[model samples]
Target: MNQQNHFALGLITLIIFLFLLGPLAIIFVASFEPTSVLQFPPTGFSLEWYRNIFTVSAFMDTFKLSMFISFLGNLCALLLGIPAAYALSRFDFRGKGLLNAIFVSPILIPGTVLGFTFLRYLIVSYSLPLEAALFIGHTILMLPFIIRVIASSMANFDFSIEEAAMNLGSSRIGAFFRVIIPNIKSGIIAGVLIAFLESFNNVDISVFLTGPGLSTLPIQMLTYVEHYFDPTVAAISVLLMIFTAVFMFLIERLVGLSHFTKR
Candidate 1:
């Protein structure tokens, strides 16, 4: 009976994995198709489409813009989120629950609603530039994720060590910098990865925030698909997959992906 149950679970896992990976497998093959249209079972294979992505000026600029926004906005999120998470984990303060709910509320809201709110609040009210609008929006969206990840790590942390340090010679701030931060390094790294990806791939928020000169790569890809139907996008998708794989590989190497997976 146990053997049968184990077999059933294994079969279920295989089916789910295949279901998720099937489309990605098709796209990987489609990207190499020499013809213009994206199709399975290509007549021939060529690197032409991959080469074509670079020739498009907007793709290059938009890619750079996406990377910049994702990295910088995530950095700001970490700067704000780490301290916020630490405080929430360590201290008792007035309105702590309310503040925690507010900090994490964005994760519960739909991205489209948040985007519209930002447009009305920042652009219409404050007349902020597109760049600033996007940066701030991404940072806000990132905060909840960063806070959650780091906060989980903090929960498992041994606060006694920090207290011991403080009882000795270290100031509270010094104890945090020297001991607490090092202990939670895995969570910080995980948060950085998750936040950067969210910022890069976000569409609903970025759609409203984009202006005349500034557009994220995902939005740019949408616009490209509207005017053109070809394997160029597939090629781009393959490249993004490769980029994501490399990033994940590095994350696994540095901190072990299990850090994020474990409760």
Candidate 2:
């Protein structure tokens, strides 16, 4: 019976892995197809679609925009979230629950609703630029992840370290920078990478926020698929998969991925 149970568990695990990775495997293989259209079991293989990704001006432009928004939005989220997380973890304050709820509300809300709300209240009412709106929207979307991750990292932290630093002539701010920040470095890095990934791959919010002369790579990919059907998008997807895998691998190397699961 134990052997039978083990076989069943192994079968389920194999199925789960295939379910997650099947489409990506298909895309990777289809990307090398010589033909313009994406298809499985290619008759011929070539790098044409991959080369086409670079030649397309829209892809290039939006790729840069996506990178810019992702990096900057994650940066802003970290700047704000670190302090916010520290406060929530360390201090007792009135409305702390309410503030925590507000911080996390973005992730809880559906992306479509969040996007429309931002469009109506933040963009239309304030008359903000598309770039500014995109930045703000992405920043908000990133806040929950950043705050939660950093706060989780701080859950097991020893406050006495900060107290000791303060006792040794470090100001509260200096102690935070020198002591607290270093202790939570792993979480901070993980949060930034996760936030960057979210902001970069965002579509529902970005679709609403984008306008002429401003677009993200995911948005561009959507628009591209609307006008054309080809392996170019597949090639792009494959490249993005590689990029994300590399990014996560680096994060794991810098700070073991287990850090997130632990605290």
Candidate 3:
């Protein structure tokens, strides 16, 4: 009976994997089509789309734009989120619970609404640039995830260690840098990775924040698909999947995925 159950579970997993990955496989295969139109079956294989990607300034620019936005957005979220997480984990204060809830509320908001709200705030109130709008939206959207991850780590951390370091004549800042930071490194890495992924793949928030002058890769793909029904977007998607998978593998090796689980 046990062996039969194991076989059934294995078959279930295989079916699920195929369901999820079959479309991805199709995207990759379609990317190599020689024809201009996006179709599954092709006349022949060609590298023209891949080659043209290098020469396409719009594609290159959007790729860089996405990378730059995710980087800066995650950095800003780290700065804002660490303090908030530490506060929640290490102290008791008036309205502490409320503050925590408010900080993470962005995650609950519909991306479309959040995007439009920030876009309105930036455009009408602050009159900020496109890049600033995107960064602010992404940073806020990712802040909760970072804070939650860090707070979970800090919850498991022993404050006595921090106290001991301080009692030994280490300054508060020194203790933080030496003891606290090292202890929370895994959580920090996880937060940063999650933040980057959120920023990188965001479409709804980005769509509202984007201006006519600037476009992100996802938005650019959307724009292209509206006018041109080509498989270039599929090719780009394949490249991004490869890059993301490689990075995730590296992250898994660096910090086991189990580390994110609550203790």
Candidate 4:
């Protein structure tokens, strides 16, 4: 009976994986079609659509902008998130509960609502640049996930090691950098992957923050799809899937996927 139950669970998991990844597989196949229109079974395989992705100058610029924003936003999120998670997990203070809730509040709020609020506050109230506002907005969106992942990693960590480092004459800051961070390195990498992907793929918040010149790759794809229906978008999607898969493989290789889960 136990073996039968295990088999059933494995079957269900496989079905779910296929359901989620089916469209991506379809898009990958469609991207290679020789014909201008998107079709599953290509009349003949060609890389024309993939090559066409570069022909659109906006795609290149937006891709660069997306990479820039995601890198900065994810970095900022990590810088803030690591310390925030450490404090929340290691310290006790007044309003700690409130502060923890607030740190992760962005995840609970609707992205569209957050975007609209940022638009009003950043532009109407303070007149900040679109790029600056977008950076801030993406960082806010990324923080909760980073904090949550790192905090969970830290929860299972043994604090005695940090204390041991301090007893050996290491300052508190030094102990953290030398001891605690290395222990939670897996969580940091996982958080970075999640945060960067979220920032890169975000569309709702980016839509509000984007202007005439600055736009993310996702927004650019949306704009292109609005006017055109070619396989170039699928080609782009395939490339992004490859990019994301490469990162995931790296994460698995460096940290092992099991580190993300609680023991």
lDDT of 4 by residue, 1-263 (tens): 99999999999999999999999999999899888788887677999989999888999999999999999999999999999999999999999999999998998999999999999999779999998999999999999989988998899899999999999999999999999999889879988997888889899899999989888999999998888877999999999999889888877775566766543
Error of 3 at 253 (Å): 2.1
Q: What is the TM-score of each candidate against the true structure?
A: 0.92, 0.95, 0.91, 0.90
Candidate 2 TM-score, true structure as reference: 0.95
lDDT of 1 by residue, 60-169 (tens): 99999999998899989999999999999998999999999999998999999999999999999999999999999999999998998898889889899999999999
Q: What are the lDDT scores of the predictions, listed in order? A: 0.91, 0.91, 0.86, 0.90
lDDT of 3 by residue, 11-125 (tens): 9999999999999999999999888998996668987788877787888899899999889888888999998899899999999989988997888888889888998898678
**Model 1 bad stretches (over 4 Å):** 1-9, 253-263
Cα lDDT tens digits, model 2, 1-263, are 99999999999999999999998998899889887777898768999999999999999999999999999899899999999999999999999999999999999999999999999977899999999999999999999989988898888799999999999999999999999999889879888887888888899999989987889999999989998888999999999998899878877875677766565
Winner by TM-score between candidate 3 and candidate 1? 1
Candidate 1: count the clashes. 0
lDDT, model 3, position 232: 82
- Give the C-alpha lDDT of model 2: 0.91
Between candidates 2 and 3, the TM-score winner: 2
* Cα-based lDDT at residue 118, candidate 4: 97
